[model samples]
Target chain A: MIVCIKQVPDTTDVKIDPEKGTLIREGVPSIVNPFDKNAVEAALKIREEKGGKVTVITMGPPQAVDALRECLAMGADDAILLSDRAFASSDTWATSYTLAMGIKKVGNPDIIFCGKQAIDGDTAQVGPGIAEHLGLPQVTYVQKIKEVKEDGMIVERSIEGGYEVVSVGMPVMIAVDKSINEPRFPTMMGTMKAHKKEIPTWGLAELGADEDKLGMNGSPTRVKRIFAPERKGQGEMIQGDDESEVCALLIEKLRDKKVV
Target chain B: MAVKIIAEECIGCESCIDACPFPGAIVMDDGIAKLTDKCNGCGACADACAVEAILVEETEVKSGIDINDYKGVWVFIEQRDNHIANVSLELICEGRKLANELGTELAGVVLGDGVEELTKYCFAYGADKAYLVDGPVFKDYRTDSYTDVIVEMINRYKPEVVLFGATNNGRDFAARIAVRVHAGLTADCTELGIDPETKQLMQTRPAFGGNIMATIICPNHRPQMATVRPKVMKKVEPDFTKTGEIIRVENSVKEEDVTTKILEIIEHATKMINLSEAEIIVSGGRGIGGPENYYLIENLAEVLGGAAGASRAAVDAGWVPHYRQVGQTGKTVAPKLYVACGISGAIQHLAGMQTSDVIVAINKDPEAPIFKVATFGIVGDIHKVVPLLTKKFKELKEAN
Candidate 1:
């Protein structure tokens, strides 16, 4: 089993670097994207049941080593970090292409798992994109795994009105939703051993990835512009000592707005 | 830069004539669409020419992927147990405009068991044609089977554009189909449009946690795909007198071909979720304090006959079920009246309910972000405020 994860800015602690006109990462904390952590949890469960090694991978800067170590503490057996200056600013398509090459180098596993989307990119394309690059069947938004048999697995997929159970053959890719399972806490022994476990960092040349498809050069989508959405204007505020007075004022205002 | 037309290859379909935004760009002379001075090398005509008779010289800007082989626009009409979803109808309505712009046919793809009868609504909503795949294997949307059906149709027909409602099923298979067909997919988009010059699908979605909006385009891939957020677009009024062609799609995918099976389906009671379509909504958050106080929010909704909603914090704290959560992670509602109590207006939460016609916020924090978007605000605790508001509304109702 192989799990893919990314290190993301903790949304709660993010601050913008006004001078640079970008998000400030100097002091802000980072964590494994919540969805990817869930993916790690799903991978750990499958490893426990099926008796296999869970190898995790990530593509990011050198500092992303912290993320790989954390996954090791969470029970992932091995971790790989694909760090290269060339990989910066890659959109989902290019990012997935680079990840697919890394997977090929690692040798194809029976199953691959990824979170539905990353909090930072919020573009759930890479998981599916990898499936396309690797030529494998995929299922997205999986809520639960019903059964894992000899050659395939049955899983429940959440839809609009109800859940549908679907089966797919092995050597498959899955993007799991949040409702799948609750993530486990890293054990004391695991945390103590995580640092001792050596993690490997791979670069573009080592992965034998084409330079054209590894970075901004290969990305098709472009951000023409970006700006914060303007906050709404001021509204009539009612503040008073008595809650009843405020409620009465609110009712009158709702009437004025023709809402009542 | 100039567009040249081949006389012998011209079919005189005149699709390029409609696709040209500039009046004199392409003119029909002797049954051939020819480029005039008005042609600025925008290249929209070349894409619209189904026969490939027109070409623009020295202005060839190729997308990363070849899009020349694709044609038509498709909407996936999502259905559950034979009941068609309203969002699917809205997509057909929206797809018609895009198709007509590109000089192509607009079609709806419907797949399910016993759903052939519901295909009529596709035409009522302006679909020029529809594809129906009916079988016991498609009784429920299995990701593998449904994906196979749609992927087969897309590969065979080669649609230039495909749209799906950002519902769970749509979100699930859309990503899969995008992968299998090697198409580019933009998810949970708030807006959809066509680039007049490039003829590429322009998909705009909220990014950076709803703090900024990003417009994305899959310029290189054929069959550009998007899953637009439900309720963001208005449904077109159905014309019952309208009719169109229904092509029965033959599918060989069988039960054995799929690996997943539904032992049972536990449906979340949907009567409350008509929350997205509700005209009025009264919602509560963590500030009301605990699950026990939730009735205060429910009481206000009941008195007004509106739906009850909750912020993610309230839902996460076990104060309410996830179905009632109103935020980026939950449901997006645009009611005529939205009364929010105790929420401080996280940007993700605001994105869900900000489109309501009337927004009223009640929170102890007077400076909460929710107040900025609110038409009216009250600085008071929800425990006291909600009950008073509910009582006052009841008295007013009795008087009326």
Candidate 2:
């Protein structure tokens, strides 16, 4: 089993660098994407039950090694970091292509997993894009996996209306949501084990990915503009002498607005 | 320049037929592709034309892309159990305006079994034409089947732009088709407009943790795709008397060919909460305190004849169920009246309910972000104020 992860800037109160039209990452704390943590837990759970090696991979800058080390502490047996300057500025399309080629280099696996969407891009395209690239079946927004049979697995996929239980064949790729499982905290012993383990690193040449499909030059989509949206006009603030008076006034207003 | 399909080099792979999005552009003759008059020289078939058989005249090419070749704006009309999605109608309203602004036709593309009868609603709403692809393969929303058909349809009759509601199914399968067709798709957009100067679609959506809104444009892609959030766009009034043309497109994907199977649909929540359709909602936050105090919210909702809503904080804390959670990760509700009690209003929570027609916020802290969008705000203790407000509303209702 292989789980793909990404390291994203913690965006609770992130600010944009208006001049460069980019996120101000200078002092912003970075963490493994919340959704990717859920996926890592899912992959580890599958390995625990199904009895297989869990190999996690991520494609990002050299600093992404920290994210892989965290996954290692989470019980993943191995970590592969695909880092290269040539891969910078890749969109979801190029990212998926590069990840697919990188995964293929590690050898074919029974299953692949990734977060439903990344916080920075919020595109949720890479998992399905990789599936298309590798010709594997896919399921997204998975809430629960009921069972993993020898040939196929049954999963409850979350939809807007409800959830549908789907049985997809093995060799399928799934993008998991937070509802799938709660990620566990790393223990000190686990941290020590991860620190002692060697993490392998690969690049475009090692993955043998086509150069045209690795970065901005290969990305089909481009960011035309990025800025803060203008705030709307202010709304009214009504106060009253007392609670009943306020409720009465609010009721009158609701009646005027045809709301109650 | 016109597209030429060389019959001899064509290996009868049907790749061209599947790749062409324009209807009537290519047809299978003796298992070989035959180009028809409907071909607009978009040359989408070039990559999939396998054998390098399909050729286009080079004189009119601009950077190897013919932008003028594609025309029309399309709205994906998603339906389930014979009910057309309201988001589809909303998208139709938006798509109709874009099509007019672009001087092109607006069509609603419906894909499902026995859904042909619902195509008239597309016209009643605003679509100039309806593209109906009917079959049992669409009985269930399978990623592989839907992606195959939609991608093939885009390749056949290349619509300049396609709009999909950012519902679960829409968000699920849209990227797959976009990736397959190599088109650009914007996700969960809150606003859609046309860039008058460049003749491009301006797709705006709240991003970066909903702190800022970014307007994305697909400058070079032929068919620009965007998935709009539900209830964000205006729902046009239906014109019952109006009728439109219905064109049936063929999709050869089979059920047995798909690798996924639906064992059953497990609807854990028996009753569906139509928060989007609710006129009034009384939502509580973590400050509402515990599960015991939930009855205060329920009583208030009962007095006002409104549904109960909760903040993600409260839901995560298990004060109320997740279905009632109104936030970015939860449902987006645009009720006529949204009363926020004790909700300190994180941006994620505000993104879901800020669009309400009238927002009344009651918080102990005056600096709560929810007050920014509220029509009325009361800074006070909810424990004392909620019970008093419930009693007053009950009295007012008795008098009315």
Per-prediction DockQ scores?
0.29, 0.28
Candidate 2 scores an fnat of 0.51
How would the docking of model 2 be graded? acceptable
- In order, what are the TM-scores of chain A for the candidates? 0.91, 0.92
What would the per-residue lDDT of candidate 1 be over residues B211-245, giving only the tens digit for each residue? 55667776666788888876677788888788889
Q: Quote the lDDT for B374 in model 2.
A: 83
TM-score of each: 0.81, 0.85
Model 2 has a DockQ score of 0.28
lDDT tens digits, residue span A1-260, model 2: 89999998776556654443334545778888888898999988988887999888999988899999999998889999999877876777778888998889888888899998877666677888888888889999898989999998999987765678999998989898767888998888889999998987888779888787677655655554444555545766667898767767777777788877
Candidate 1 chain B least-lDDT 10 residues: B57-66
What are the runs in model 2 whose C-alpha is more than 4 Å off? Answer: A15-25, B1-65, B268-280, B298-307, B332-334, B387-400
- What fraction of correct interface contacts does each candidate retain? 0.50, 0.51
* lDDT of all predictions: 0.79, 0.81
